[model samples]
Target: MVPPLVLDIDGTMTRPDDSVDPRFFDVLPQWDAPVVIATGKSFPYPVSLCHFMHIEQNVIAENGGVVLSGEQVTTNGDGEAARRVAEEYVAAGHDIGWGQTDLTNRWRETEIAVARDQPLGPLEELAAEHGLEVVDTGFAYHVKSPRIEKGLGLKSLAPLLDRTPEEFAAVGDSENDVSTFGVAGESYAVANADAKAQRAADVVLEESYSEGTLSVLEDLRERA
Candidate 1:
């Protein structure tokens, strides 16, 4: 069986300020099953949670874009198509940026981060000429890599975890979490999620991000 829940960080587990819900920490320890953090966030954020939560399992970072199973690291270059799309936007000069994530907390000075960055600028025109869509991740704008977003990321990790589509769940509250929601057994979005997220979620949280993390996980606890 796969881990019961795959939690998306950022807008799901924490607020836009990068704070994890204390309530989640308060209650997660009592659960007996494994917690796999599935996120578009870099490695450091999830790593900190894993250490503090005493969680030991595979982590899917980079929006399910990268898989870290213990010491192993596998990133799907599938974002290549998406990268090209993003570059088109950059080339067009509309102000889009991408490559990798650099979000972090000052307290966790040396957290592990995945996703690399490329130079930005003069690409927006490129995207416009090509008529491609650019995905905005709050911190940066992703032009296009592939259909290889979060859902594909999860699909990549499925075999390694030995889980089917119906056995695992994904939870989040933002645009980056959409692809994950597409493939999760059960999907949820936090109350703070934007319209796009609301459309994708199977359930929406009543609690804010702080409490939402716990509430979302509590749903997982029921399955656990």
Candidate 2:
């Protein structure tokens, strides 16, 4: 049986132009399950990805701090916990990207058509400089506003479907993805995954980005 899929768009599926492999969409529709996007993107940014991928499913954003469906956003995070994490990042001295930024400004700055790319950082130094928590997956360092992780966000979603974290499969590459991988039954990363992420993955794609994701899809199909 095809299992539900959770994908990270930036490093996993696209380069920077919001372009994803058509084959991915082609095969994706065949899988009879929801595809949740767990990313740092906020507001209208992720909605565009859903349109591009032809997906009308649930999404987890802010590295799992925010959950969105249709036009509604939900919070499964602890209020004090979120506040404390944000305070820590600030105290550490890194520029934290949180909530919704001006989508137009983000696009103008990054040249990407989506608002998700607005969160920027040279993560390792940013973290080291400020003693902040940086989730490094290898490709880029996302400036996390709250220490709340994507894995936790995805885990909170279990109650919505009555499924366990082990039933889902997460695919990504980056420090932000580490927690997500831990939350999946069959976690995977691309060839470019950082050492920590790679170690946690059940499979590592030989190819990077879209190629790598498809490879894992093939393997999962076979195993299924």
Alpha-carbon RMSD of each model: 6.0, 6.3
Task: Tell me how candidate 1 scores on lDDT.
Answer: 0.60
Give the C-alpha miss distance for residue 196 in model 2, angstroms: 2.1
Model 2: worst 10 consecutive residues (lDDT sum) = 107-116
What shift in Å separates residue 169 of candidate 1 from its native position after superposition?
A: 2.1
Query: 83-171 in candidate 2: lDDT tens per residue?
Result: 34434545765434434673432422111111233243434344445444544433323434345677887777755766777888889
* TM-score, every prediction: 0.70, 0.70
Candidate 2 is scored at a TM of 0.70
Q: Write the per-residue lDDT of candidate 1 for residues 9-93, one digit (tens) a residue.
A: 7777776587776666756566554457776555566777877876665677655556766676676554444445544444654
Which portions of model 2 miss their true places by more than 4 Å? 15-18, 69-72, 76-132, 136-141
Q: How close is candidate 1 to the true structure, as a TM-score?
A: 0.70
Candidate closest to the true structure, highest lDDT: 2
Measured with C-alpha atoms, the lDDT of residue 205 in candidate 2 is 78
